[model samples]
Target: MATKPEFLLIGPGGVGCIAAFTINYNHTANVSIVVRRDYETVRKHGYHIDSVDYGKVDGWKPENVFASVEEASKSGIKFDYIAVSTKNLQDIVPVEELIAPVVSAHSVVVLVQNGFGIEKPLFAKFPQNIVLSGVSHIGSHNRNGHIHQMQSDHLVISAFENPNVDADSQVAAANRFIEMYSNNINKCVYFASAKWYRYRKLVYNACLNTTCALTGVDTGRLEAAGGLEAIAIPAMKEVIRVAKADGVELPDDVINVVCHADDGDYFEPSMRVDVKKGNPIELEAILGNLLDTARKLKVETPILDLLFKLLTVVQFRLKEANGYVGVPEKRPIPDTFFK
Candidate 1:
């Protein structure tokens, strides 16, 4: 009999918890999660998941839980897949560095995070391994070891295009993941063009996600303050234009689709939640990378440029206040300047 495939997921947050649950529940693989901060809580009591697709469950956990990737690496079992569901804050620490300790020669790295151009560094670091982009469309929130997954888990999995890896190998790796992840309870489909999906998601992420963080409000509040029309729509349009310049033609009604996708629900974007909690946002991965692509294609994105500039300051302040190393030493403004 063939041995069960070993799957290790990092960051047992909303997406990670769901991924671990579905894979383990379906008996598809032997699942493990690398947790930090919440390790003790989760290891002691397990995870409490209230999922829309899987129904409510209490004290649920993966087959194995490690304190960190380094700890997981020391377990003597090589992982076939390493799925990362953490925030893609590349500015603070590269994602490649975090997972490198546990990545095996045959391991396929699966990214279940949001951001444009997030796979470049990972591609550079793990040239031989397949990097699958799992674009998740799920409304979920997690606090401590408890998770509330409201929306259905519809993950679009695709292999990031890599020159170093052959197309057949990449597709096979992605299809294997789709086979392992998909079951009667959830949907995990293979997408041929992951870049198109990433661009589509940016219509909302680049606009509402950044603007809400800047205004320090939820989507409804931002809409009420006229920011939806004044800031978000224009930025979203700019994203469409940039996507076009990058050769991905989005539908004409995409802006409207993104605007009303949530149906006026009161929700905070992940970036806004990060700002509120004093956590570093994925500014570089989300906005900076897209803007870089736009610049290369000579696409004009005035609104996004403005948002990026403003958020750069926000990110700087958060890093400084949080005492992140490499932040410049503080210096008071000169009193003589006022004179």
Candidate 2:
């Protein structure tokens, strides 16, 4: 390991930027962010963040910024961790192809993304490297290319349970990673079962994210328009049921907490923002993956099934509105990844 932990954070959107800011603000680790669109602007002015919780920070630059992972990888610098906030790129490019140049034999790979089965391809390639799954409860979004910090509790974290990998090493690496990040933001809770962590976050994403996207509103508006009871609550119920079928039990009152987030903590989720911007939403990762798993488990998610069909229609329409014709490529999941 290097004397100081360095990270290559891919996809500097809401989720990615918050993590980048938290670490960079606390000066916890040296962060190298991949600035895909606004390289020059970010390199010069950095970002101006407005927040209700994290306070305001104007013009903060990370340690290093690269246009792409390939560019960063060629710097002859191996990062201790690679944090990805986008959908898994197994279909577009192999994980090894993307991060091989930036990692050593013992690099810890952590993905703070929303979805299921995010670890399969990574484990398939790097059977010995530590792999972790993170669940972010942050109610934040990006506005005019800056992260808007809203509210959050604990960031649920866990390393995946892989039979082929050394379990003890994974736990130790996870604890070390969490320790490096404990100085900033909020609490970092280490959950032993990454499987359970992923599904529980899906309870909110599969319900609120999709509901807000389809209705063209934020969580608070959805609750105001009565979509909370008419839509969100039922969808969460389906999520709980499917989670159980997959052998993860959830609490009975999760619905109340999931729907009514704090009183003024209403912000458009990334899904709603993506739909409005005519960009392809993370439908597959947040919704498609869940529906697929529900099917494998033979769990009947009537509400979720309906919302899935409806959201796909809205997603297609939004893409068309943006003049994007080609459908996004989907990844084929292996049966071995399932529990």
Candidate 3:
């Protein structure tokens, strides 16, 4: 009999739970979830998934749950793949330690998170050969202890191709990972060249996330307010220009998709949630990255610059108010043609 691929998921947050559930539900992979604590809770309660599409699935326990990577290592457990889904701001030290023992030179490490260039920091810690960067449009949040999946879109996997890593091999691996959830489901997994996938996602995020965050409205409402023509269209053009300056080739249709994507009303950008909850937003990851890239490539980004400035002020005001409970003055975007 073929041995099941050992999969280890670090963190049991919304994304982590969905990944764990997806992997366990569809594939024969021997999956385990590593948590900082709450092993008892997970063991007793199992994994609970409340999805708008899949409905509620309860009492589904992982093959194993470990409190820490240290514990898993001491128990002599080895993982073929490690999926890191921690919050973007969490210290990477713990994650490094967790992957240290289990990650081999050949083992694949898939990072399912938002933002651009998140793989750079990890590359400094681990060999680039084993690192794979992924971006997904999967919306999920935790309610009580259950994970609620709001939407499932395509999962894009990318990494710098190496001789040991055949192009087809990565695609096959990505498909295996997707099959963990795509059975009879319309959701598909795509493996593509890192440059195109990363930049495409970057453009989509740069437009959609920033607009949703700045407007403090849901995606549907934002799209309804001529956001595509006003914000997303302009912002996406800037993204394409910046990507071109950076030598990243983007498709002509990328802008159209960003402007007209069916992201659903239930979709909530992380930055908007952070602003609403008064948590520190990923200004650096979403907007800051675009601005920085533009500067690096000598590309002008007036729209992004104005957007970033507005968001910075909004964030500061929120911090001053201690939360979004009180209303703040609505700042108008300075007049400028970014083209």
Candidate 4:
């Protein structure tokens, strides 16, 4: 009999735990996870999940769990799909370096994170491997070993073209992943290109995520302060303009859909949560990269530019507190390091 395909997920945060749960729930492949802080708690007690879509499932564990990717690499298993659902904080460490130990030539790297230009570095690092870009719209948070998934989950995935790898092989790997991962309970759709979805998501994120972090408020508070109309909507319009300049034209109605996305049921975005915990936010991947593209395309984005500048100060404070001072040195790994 043919062996079942192997799947591994790094970063068992809110998003990572839920994805691992659902993928293991499907039981189409062998699922494994690499967890850091909560490894002991999870390995002993397992995950306590309360999801609206999947309902309550306590003491849930994947087939195998490890403390780190380096540990998982020594398990004598070649991973078919390695999904990363961590925050895209490239300043701290590149995603490419984090999962380098287990990325085989046959393995497909799936990025289930936010921000623009996130897939570029991974592609450059693993041109021989197929890299898939994923944009996840899920509302979940993990406190200790307990996870709460308040909103329904939706993931849009697409393969990033690699000149070194052929097109047919890339699509085949992507389809295999979707086949094993997607089910009747959770939604994961395959799109032709994930660029449009990335831009559309920023219509909500670049405005509310940044503003909430700076002002230390939630969505309802921002709307109550007239920021929904004054700050969020206008900034979303600028994002649409920038997307248009970059060849992805977003509809005008997206402003209304995104601005009032959380009308009465409002919660804090990830950036605000990071700010509350004094963690470094994804400053470069989300706003800085978008603004760089705007400047190159000659698109006017005064609102986003101001938000970027102010958020940079917030980021500097977090970095200073963590003592990440001065320029970072280049971290070089062997080109043939993958198994």
Candidate 5:
């Protein structure tokens, strides 16, 4: 009997939860998940996902479930592919830090996460390792431990095109993920320019995620309240401008794609859910970093500037309220942060 290809996914958030389930549901690999604190419940009750297109799934279990990276590393298991799908809240614990324990020279590391400039740090750390970038369009969240898949499209992933990237390992990891994720419930595709795709995803993420989170509203609320035209579209245009400055020729029509893709008008993005739950949001990776790049490139982003300011205050208050020491930002919430 032959052994199945090993896959390790860290961070059981929206994309992580679905990716883990999809791998198991598709029989893709001997999938092992590294969830932060939901082991006992998930192991006993399994993961319950209420997928809109796929219907309800009760307690779908993976091949193996581990709590931390050290556990998997200590076991002397070598994974063919290792993916990090956690929030890009590296200030809490970098995506690299968690996966470093289990990563080997031959392992393919997929940063299935949000934000721009995220994959650079890992690529610098392990040049020999095959590094891939991934972005998800799935509208879902694991509220109270069960995943709620509200909406979705194909997950976009791509491998390193640089000459230095290990050809064999990198190609195999990218194709393998595509093969596994092309199931009835969902689809995953590969593109030549992942960096370009990252910037495109950022249009929705930076605009909608931040706007929705700060306003404490979903897409529907933004539309209902007429904030979409007032705030969301402007913020998205700024992202497009910044992307062009970075040499990525993104189309202006993408702004319309985001505006129309506001499925059901009530879909809550991951960042919005994080803010509502009082969990620390990815302020730096998602918003500030992009703003920083725009500044460096001398790109004018007045709209993004204001969004960054408001979202930072939201982050500060949410962290303080939750009693979690989050990544420091420019502003501090006043004593009367809540009226």
Candidate 6:
């Protein structure tokens, strides 16, 4: 009998919870979720996954849960795959330190966070061969300590064949990882050839997240106003220009599928929720990366530049007014929108 591959998911937030539940439900991987000390509530209450596509799931618990990476390491448990789905602003230094001792030399780390340039910093510490990048169009939120997954479009993973890893081995590994979650969720996971998935998702996120946060409107209102195409088309073009300079060959359909999709208001991006809660928005990950790439490629992105500056100012002001701490309560809808 073949042994089940062991997986460790760092962080138990929305994305992390989805990843853990998906992996556990499929039973293809032995998954463990590493959370903070406060996650004892999860130990008692278990997890409730309320998904729009898959329906409701209750009493779902991980194979194991640990308060800290150090504790998991002390247990002498080695993981074959490590997936991280934490927020963008989190400091991963401690995670890297604690997990390093428990990761086998052949173990692969899949990062499902936002942004484009995250791999560079991670590769600096870990072997480039063992690092992989992924992007997802999954929308989710936490309500009253339960995870509500609103949408699952598709997950794209970038596969690379390192000198230490053969092409067939890497392909097999990627396939196994994809199949592990194929049945647990409604979305499809595609393993793409190049690393363009990150850039493609970056373009989609930059426009959707920034616009929704700035307007303080839901996606439905944004679409109703016919402003999606106006903002998204130009932003995608600028991203394409910058990506090409970086030697990435993005497909023409990336923009068409991402920007022109007809998903309903249920598709609220994470940045929108962050702004609604008055938390620090992921400006650095979504827009900062775009502007940084443009600067490097000498591409002009005046629209993106303007949007980034505006969002930064709004985030700063909101933080200052809200005492710069704690999640903000949902704000009341404006009278202007009620008309």
Predicted structure with the largest TM-score when compared to the true one: 1
Candidate 2 on 1-339: residue-level lDDT in tens?
Answer: 557788778878777788887777666688889887777778888887877657788887788999888889877678888887765534334455676667678678888877777677677777777887777777677655687877753576799877777788888888987887666457777898998877877878888889888889988888889998898888888888888998999877777766655458787877887788777777767777788888999988888888889977876676667665555568556669566
What value of lDDT does candidate 5 attain over all alpha carbons?
Answer: 0.81
Q: In candidate 4, what are the lDDT values of residues 1-339, reduced to their tens digit?
A: 478888899988888888888888888879999999999999999999999989999899999999999999999789998999888888787899999999998888998998887877888888798988877778888999999999888887888777788888887777888888799878888887677878888888899999999999999999999988898888988899899988998876898788678878678988998999999999877888888889999999999999999998888889877778543367666589577
lDDT of each: 0.90, 0.77, 0.71, 0.87, 0.81, 0.72
TM-score of 4: 0.89
The digit string of per-residue lDDT tens for model 6 on 83-131 reads: 8777665222333554576676767887777876665545556654465
Model 4 segments more than 4 A misplaced = 326-339
Best by lDDT: 1
Residue-wise C-alpha lDDT for candidate 3, range 1-339, written one tens digit per residue: 688888888877877787777778776688988866567777788767887556799877788888787777676766777888875542213345556766766577887766665555555566444566666667777655678888864566665344445667766666665555465653655656665666787777777777888888867877778776788778888988988887888887877776556565556667788888776666656677668778988999898888888888876666567554455388678699898
lDDT of 4: 0.87
On lDDT, who's better, 3 or 6?
A: 6
Query: Which residues of candidate 1, in runs, are more than 4 Å off?
Result: 325-339
lDDT of model 4, residue 138: 84
Question: Candidates 1 and 5: which is better by TM-score?
Answer: 1
**Each candidate: how many clashes?**
0, 0, 0, 0, 1, 0
Q: What would the C-alpha RMSD of candidate 3 be, to one decimal place?
A: 6.8
Ranking by lDDT: 1, 4, 5, 2, 6, 3
- What's model 5's lDDT at 276? 76
Structure candidate 3, residue pairs in collision: none
Every model's TM-score:
0.93, 0.81, 0.76, 0.89, 0.84, 0.78
Task: RMSD for all candidates, in order, please.
Answer: 2.6, 6.5, 6.8, 7.3, 4.7, 7.4
lDDT of 5 by residue, 216-259 (tens): 89998898899999999888888988998999988858988888
After TM-score superposition, the amount by which residue 116's alpha carbon in candidate 4 deviates from its true location, in angstroms, is: 1.3
